[model samples]
Target: MDLNHSINFSSSSSTSSPFDDFIPLDSFMLPDCDPHLSTKEEEDDEAKRSSFTQLQKENIDLFWNQQLFEIQNTPVRKTHHEFPIARVKRIMKSDGKVKLISSETPILFSKACELFIMELTLRSWLHTEESKRRTLQHCDIYRAIRNDQLLDFLVSIANLF
Candidate 1:
């Protein structure tokens, strides 16, 4: 089969030339945007950002106030074995040389432990509020742990539990 015979050489009957069908690229191009127009959009974006930040701060403050209210309204009670006195004695004993713990030592340690727990809970709750969350979560505690370099060891130890 001849390759020349396979191809059609017939001319089109249409009157429109190739240049007539062609569209100018500039016509399809985007119009020049005003620099001032973007500045207006930027101002709008800045306003939205500031408003969002203010909203978050307000939420945090509200959460903190609610927590403070709850703390004030709640009655403080002293419960027996609330702080694991025996565990404290064991820990003191585990120091190798000190095999015996005085009876009064456990009682004082228990009170100290209670205070420590309350303080840590308050701090962790504040961290939660800072994140604009009303409810406290474990991640808040983790964040607290991470924020304090002294608690880095506790973070690894607490993960086991």
Candidate 2:
């Protein structure tokens, strides 16, 4: 080969160049933008979300916060619960070291369990929505748990696959 060969600076043939195709920024789609390009399911999801009034949306969006506020302001009750207090008591007493549990313990535990469940489900539902999925899968729960540092204790139980 020649020591000082000149590199070709031009294409003589009619084959199209890679950069010939112009891609405008508007051509690229993003979430919740360009509704005309959205699928039926996406439209339905949007409609559902839009159906909620501003106040309802605010309450839903700040569910955990609102729940904490209500708990702090409300008086404690001993009326058992929607969740069976007896079952909660049984589960608590299942531990070998648990010799005695106060009457109030089961009521509190049952309420706590209900609150925990609602919070976790809300978080997992958010993950499902983020993934643009209507169904709440196990992975959503795992993702929710992984995303929150406080839920790290559940990470071992909810293995990411």
Candidate 3:
């Protein structure tokens, strides 16, 4: 590209980046620009910057939330009105009360406690680093089910079915 085109591209590129675009290098008192002074001007600049950042964050969050909602709401074809064989096997093969929690993206459980322990155990285990203990202690699992956070996510999944 020509020098003029390259410079233009670079300037636009810095602005387009999600993180860096919010604050241009020069705007942060880079040696090239006239120093910004005065409390009112600084406050105004700060306000503008924060507002822009907030808008950007909100827009990005909304975009992902909508995308997730779309995916969550998408319909699936059922093969036989019976649960998929893989899912049935997965649930049946689980070691204990965990089987009560279904893999059906939208989960359903007859007992709240059954759903709670299983979902949290699955999520916590998956997020755990390999070096970390694979299983949570029994007390923690009991507490998690008591708190119901696990049940909530499970219900969200169950509702999908």
CA RMSD per model (angstroms): 12.0, 11.7, 20.7
Inter-residue clash pairs, candidate 2: none
Task: Kindly list the per-residue Cα lDDT of model 1 for residues 21-135, writing each as its tens digit.
Answer: 5666784496777767687898898997677557545655676687578658966443574577778888888899997777878877886676557656765776776678999
Q: Per-residue lDDT of 43-104 in model 3, one digit per residue for the tens?
A: 88899757755654565466557656854796644443233456555655675655444445
Better of 1 and 2 by lDDT: 2
TM-score for each of the candidates: 0.44, 0.57, 0.26
Which parts of model 3 have CA positions greater than 4 angstroms off? 1-35, 76-161
Candidate 1 root-mean-square deviation in Å: 12.0
lDDT minimum window of 10 residues, candidate 2: 51-60
Q: Rate the local accuracy (lDDT) of all candidates.
A: 0.69, 0.76, 0.49
lDDT of 2 by residue, 37-94 (tens): 5587788887765653343345456996888898899898777486898888889889
Where does candidate 3 have its weakest 10-residue lDDT segment? 105-114
In candidate 2, stretches whose alpha carbon ends up further than 4 angstroms from where it belongs are: 1-61, 72-75
> By TM-score, how accurate is candidate 2?
0.57
